[model samples]
Target chain A: MRVLLVDDEEELVATLAERLEMRGITACWVTNHRAALEAVDRERFDIALLDVRLPEMNGLDLKRLIEAKQPTMKFIFLTGHGSEEDFNACSAESGREYYLIKPVQIDVLTAKLHEICAEQGDRQ
Target chain B: MNGSHGKVDTLGLDYFGRMTASISHEIKNGLAIINENAGLLGDLVALTDKGRPLDPARLETIAENIRRRVQHADDIVRRLNQFAHSVSGPVTTVTLREIVESTVALAHRIAAMKGIAFTFSQDDTIKVETIPFILQNMVWICLKNIFQRHDSDTNLTLDFAFQEIETDVVIVMNFSHEIDTAATKAAISEEGKPIILFLKAQIYNDQTNRTIQLRMPKKFID
Candidate 1:
């Protein structure tokens, strides 16, 4: 699946992208919202993995902007320090299935990606 | 001092939690990178055969990356420890520059998320006896207020000048955008105002010049 990764942590994003590639997934990553936006404009990504605390904009805000641009593009938020309150707030605003805390297991992430893709395919 | 003690305590706890969360997130990101690099190295090893030699250069690069992340995490933990210790003593003698620097470090992640650059200039050696925790909280509140009002590209300059004749230190925060008086007033109201009173510090906002000035006495007595 084609995926877009957005995070300010350059090393994390780069490494994650390489691992995803190793797993036979095509992943493109960027470190800021502007670059993420530009990447979305330039390519068709099936899903965008976004870091909640971003450089130019927070992940939730960026999700909204990207959704406006590509309504069908799916999103999964990554946060390193999300409290219960933050989780509840995000869930209340955007539902529960889209958020993931950091230090996420690659296998779990891959499983979620597959699940999201399957869900999208079913919807289509 | 008009706010309730419970409210002040809650605010301090909230600030502590927020800083801790941010710092932990930073450290977690560092660890995540190291983890990913290690995983990649494992993948490389698995792909190697008994007859073929593993690329030592690639292995060295991954190890170096892990080491760098470890050092980065250490720095973050050090800053977090310093921040936590600031509240240990109710009252202490602290240099204005030191507090500003510490507060800036504590607020660095928040500012970085908004793409705001903080420039601090304090050549004068000005020390004051006060509650460092409360002072730090005051500065953090002011920064949060400013960051919330301004855009990501905004640059903030904090300049410290000591008035020897008046025996006071003035901290001027200069930004590009015009100060939102209403929002600024709200930020300084309630819990924030009480802390300012507790610190015996006076705050002034110049809308025309887009500057916020904080004046503090050389000595604070409870």
Candidate 2:
């Protein structure tokens, strides 16, 4: 599956992209609002992994703009500042499958990515 | 800006919570990076089990990343510790530059949320005897007021410069919120008057230049 990873922490997202590539996922990463928007504008991504907090704009706001451009793209949020309780509350609205906290287990992330894509019947 | 013991107490708790939350968010980011670094190492190890040779340079890079991230987290904790200890005494001796830097560091995430940048510098450092926590809170309140007042079309950086005025320190803050000096000064006065009275800091507004200068004595006598 092709994925777009957006987070201000460059090394974290870059390494994640590398790992995803190793797992046969075509993933690209960006560090801020502008670049992430630009990437989605220029390239097609099946799913997006976004950090909830960004320096300049809310990641959810960025997600809306991206969704406008790529209406069918899937999403998973990764947050550092939020607690599991916060995630649970957000999950009630967004879904339990939609959020992951920092220090993610690779197995869990990979499985979630597959699950989300499989639900779309577009497993890659 | 209400001068009441209960109000100040509430404000202190609120400021403390904000600072703690900001510091923890920063530490969590550092931890997140370190997590990715460690996970990359695990990925490398898994490759080795499959008969793929490990690239020594890549291992070193991961190791270095972890090291650097650890130091980053440590520095964040250190600053938080210092900030926490700032309230250990009602009054203490501290360098004006150091306290201002600490205040700015703590306010960074708050500013980033507003897309506001800060530029601070001082050619000379002056030591002062004052209430560190209260002084920091006052400066932070003023900065927050500036952030709230900033309604310009573009993202703006607040410029702050410190000058020694004999026995006092003057922090000159410059920004481009508006050219209406009277209105800006009135807004600041409405919001920050109580803290200004408490700290005995005089504030000057220069509308033409778009600046607010806060001047306070170096020594606190209580």
Candidate 3:
């Protein structure tokens, strides 16, 4: 599946994209909201993985903006904050099944991504 | 300082929690990068075999990346430790430049998130005796107050100028726009009264010149 990774950490997002490509999944990454929007406008990405605590605009708000642009695109949030209050805030914005904490295991992340694709397949 | 005991308690707890959270978030971001880089190294080992040799250059690059992130995280932790020790004693003698620099270092991350930059004008630096924690908290609060009043401009900047007036040291926080007088007054008078009293400091809102001049005495006595 084609994926878009949005995170301010350049090395983290770039390395994740490289690894995803090695696993035969197409992934493109950007470091900010404006760049993320530009990438989406340029290409069709099935999934967008966003870091929740972005600099200018938080990832949840960016999710809304992207959803307006690409209604069919799905999202998965990545956050470094592990507090219950932070979790609740993010889950309240997106459903509970939609976020992964930082230092996330790649197997779990890819599993979730495939699960999302399968869910879409089921919907169709 | 009669009813201020409770205000101090509330403000201390509140500021302590927020500052810890912001700094910890920064540390976490650094850790996340290290995690991904290390995981990539393991991935490389798994993909290596007899026919296909592993690239030493790529491995070296990844190793270097991890080292850089470790140093980055170490620096953040050092800053956190510095902040924690700010309240180790009741009060201490410190330079005005040192106070501004330390507080700015702690706050620069939070400010950058909203695109705020602090410019310092240190013409003449003087020494003062004050509670380090309270003084830093006061400066941080004044920053928040300015942000609340003047964040309409997308490109926001706060300028800090230090001046000496006889026996007093005044650190003026200049703004990019003419701040709201009523809002600034209400915020300053109500929000940081405990801190103002604690540090024996006064916050004067110079709205005409778009500045908040924080005047503190050279000798602080409890």
Give the best candidate by lDDT.
3
User: lDDT of model 2 at residue B118?
Assistant: 78
lDDT of 3 by residue, B57-117 (tens): 9999999999999998899899888888775446688877778777788877778777788
lDDT string for model 3 (A9-108, tens) is: 8888999998888788899999989999999899998899999888788898999999989988889999888788768877897788888898888888
Quote model 1's iRMS.
1.3
Return the lDDT, model 3, position B194. 84
Query: Residue B150 error for model 1, in Å?
Result: 0.9
Candidate 1 per-residue lDDT over residues B1-222, each given as its tens digit:
334556666678888988888788788888788888988887778767545568999899999999999998999999988788876556788787777778888888888777566665555477777788878888888888877777666554444444433777776677655558456846665448767766678878777776777788877856
Candidate 2 lDDT tens digits, A24-60: 8999999988999999989998899988887767667
Instruction: Judge candidate 2 at residue A60 and give its lDDT.
Output: 74
TM-score of 2: 0.88
Clashing pairs in 1: none
Residue B122 local lDDT, model 1: 50
Pick by DockQ: which candidate is best?
A: 1
Q: Candidate 3: lDDT of B48?
A: 75
CA lDDT, candidate 2, residue B218 = 81
Q: At residue A97, what lDDT does model 3 achieve? A: 89
